[model samples]
Target: MSSAHITFDTTGDKIARRVRKMRSSAVRDLFAAATRDDVISLSGGMPAVSLLPVEDVRAATLAAVESPEARAVSLQYGPTNGAPGLRAVLADMMRDLGIRVKPDQILVTTGAQEALSLIAEAFIDPGDIIITEGPTYLGALQAFSAFEPDVRAIPFDDEGMRMDLLEEELKRIGKGNPRLKYCYVIPNFQNPGGVTMVAERRRRLLELAREYDFMVVEDDPYGRLRYDGGHQVPLKAMDENVIYLGTISKMLGPGLRTGWIAAPESVLARINLVKQGADLCGSSFDQIIVEHYFKDIPWQKTLQKFVAVYKERRDTMLAALEEFFPPEATWTHPEGGMFLWITLPDYMDTDSMLAEALEAGVTYVPGNSFFPDGKTGRNSMRVNFSFETPESITEAIRRLAKVIEDRLELYRVFIEAGALPGYDRKEAAMTDEKTPTPWEEVVADSEQNEEAVMQAREGNAEQIDIAEEAVRDAQQAAAPAEEAAE
Candidate 1:
């Protein structure tokens, strides 16, 4: 009866082969729960949109349709590259990060998300080798998965992606490999990880990219959100050839849906061709709103307010985690960002633990979702501080810690029952340092909690049950007597 019916009748799968292989980030289900008033969700990397001044945004939106001349441009289709004024504003914004770029070199898209997919479409071929941090942005993994690239992820530490390890892999891949397309990085307050790439590491990455003859794609969503750190020069600042992605989603609001790619003119030329097919051009109305927001508004003061609030939230979450989480767990100490990474005992699986967390009135993005493979980092989960109140963050951590403790109890049972075939108690300790085992501490604490709850409730349990039965009997007797009389 329709085109959809005809497609289903003709096509066996109704999906492209490449697209069929792609998988969701396993967050949509959790997001549904996150919206519930009873749940404290640490899953989404949403900014505190309530912190942005409403009057300021209202003024920006009003400016878009203020006059006939404004409506002529804002409401009409424009260049695929971007609005000229917005591009200039973006270039000026880049100047603050020491990235000098011409307006002509920028390509505006729906969001930085669209930029990622376009980059994958422009460069990636089937089975092409691409490099990213081991636990990278989940959205990037989702974007690139459509192309079926053989993703090779390198490990990272506090300083950021280990350049020494990257160099080792670069040598393994050898020089000038055509299949090695690009080295994509989120150098500043990386998603999920919350670790910044130090200046020396940034330089080393650029050097390796040069030697390997591969493009360096920098996805800097949180660069301007710094709270207490010295500046780390952007990769684009060091080398103009680096493809830098910038977004107003963090500073302004994601609802505007504006982001731009500052790349070489040659790169823009290719991507612009692809962009024409992917939406003809971005929403002109949205671009106009953004241009005025940056140009007409004193966005700096608002940005400062965001930093202060975020810093307090981040610290609150950190302090709560310190006080609540088991000693077996570890998490990154981010100077500034919306999210932080928390890893639990290796024997634990966060993906599996999520159900209990939801039941406990909290939710988090399981760490494995960030990996290119769907099944790694099973012991870790990413928590957000930006969306929740300080009190909520603290309570969420406390609930999550209980979930972890429950898992620890199960593991202890397995160990005591000798269900683990080859586990060595000493070698399997959560930490190498000498301390009380998490199993022992968790069991002891659980016992104390159980005792307290039982003492409070069990004392009156028999009497309450007897009284409830007697009331039920009385109701049953009265019902029969009243029915007989009737």
Candidate 2:
């Protein structure tokens, strides 16, 4: 069916090197597998549409269509900077996150995806250096990769990206590549990882950005979806040099395709110019619809419902992982959001596991695709728990664990039979004769984490001081209660 030698000439505007350099995202292909009846996908980072405040959106839509002013807004082309009322609403929302921005600073886009794409078009030059979390959002990677930027990933822990490693990366940027542009971060309930950068790190990161003089793109589509509790300050809140990208997709409806970016005037202007070519402006109809939706909809009530549903799902997934997953397979316990990251033993390849997982009627996004550098997260995978039911979560994890068990067993058998290299193929194999039992390895990891926690407690004298101060304040307020108890 294939010819060995074929000469074909293609002439009309050949693919540019920058476009050619970019690769199709591995995660994008996941949707096809996800749609199958056999597969219970933990792969897609999609919010459940059934959970959205559809009635509220419908009410707003009817009101918008009926009103003369709103009808005009829907019919006519709007400004590139977005509708004025929506911009004001967005500014108010930003104030809650401690980001003070005016209407002029906000440029609305089709979605957060477009905001990132336009930013990449505006700012990233070929061979420019950009930084992101080691296991970052795949959408961002796809957006920025098209610009042919030399992307580097900073290491991340449960607390978020390692600031120490980020500092070192910043130091290398100008020396290694003079056109070094900016860093992108998802500070709260980060995609794939589900780790929130603590408040202290947010301040410290701003300090580092100021010191380095490189921009920080704070991409926060899911910050508002924090199911556990209180708000974390956006990185842009502390730094004027940062660009804040936000979306209503998670909370409202992705069908609206509404997202916005808050940045300094200069950057906003440049992004607008880039926006001129890409759809000219985000749909005027959608913008007006959203503005009306925000006005008519009681978002607080919708938010409460979302919190309750997602929290239940989160609890269900965590319980399932505990019950079914092997002790060696480590997973993050996210307080909020759709995803949790899992790390298998160093010998496991998530990409290879994905094929087996699909065959077993379960699916997950391979973690390596999240990393700016492709090979770093070979042992990890991202799981989405928010979209599935409790029973589905239980069944999916059971299947996944069976797949992993079978793979490990097969690996052992291959080595024993001499079908695989005899304990020395370090390049292609992660497992060898020395691999420990799953239970023992996971137990050891747990102990190590406990020890680390104890060590941190011992070292952190300031934490104790703060706790003591809080106790003193509480005692003073509750003196009458103390006396009654005595």
Q: Per-residue CA lDDT of candidate 1, range 159-199, in tens?
A: 89999899999999999899999999999998889999999
Q: Could you tell me every candidate's TM-score relative to the true structure?
A: 0.86, 0.82
Computed on alpha carbons, the lDDT of every model, listed in order, comes to 0.85, 0.78
Encode model 2's per-residue lDDT on 7-58: one tens digit a residue: 7768536877777667677767888888999899888777777876667878
| Model 2 residue 38 lDDT score | 86
- Candidate 2 stretches with Cα past 4 Å from truth are 1-13, 174-177, 412-486
Clashing pairs counted in every model: 0, 1
Which ten contiguous residues of candidate 1 have the minimum total lDDT?
440-449
lDDT for position 417 in model 2: 32
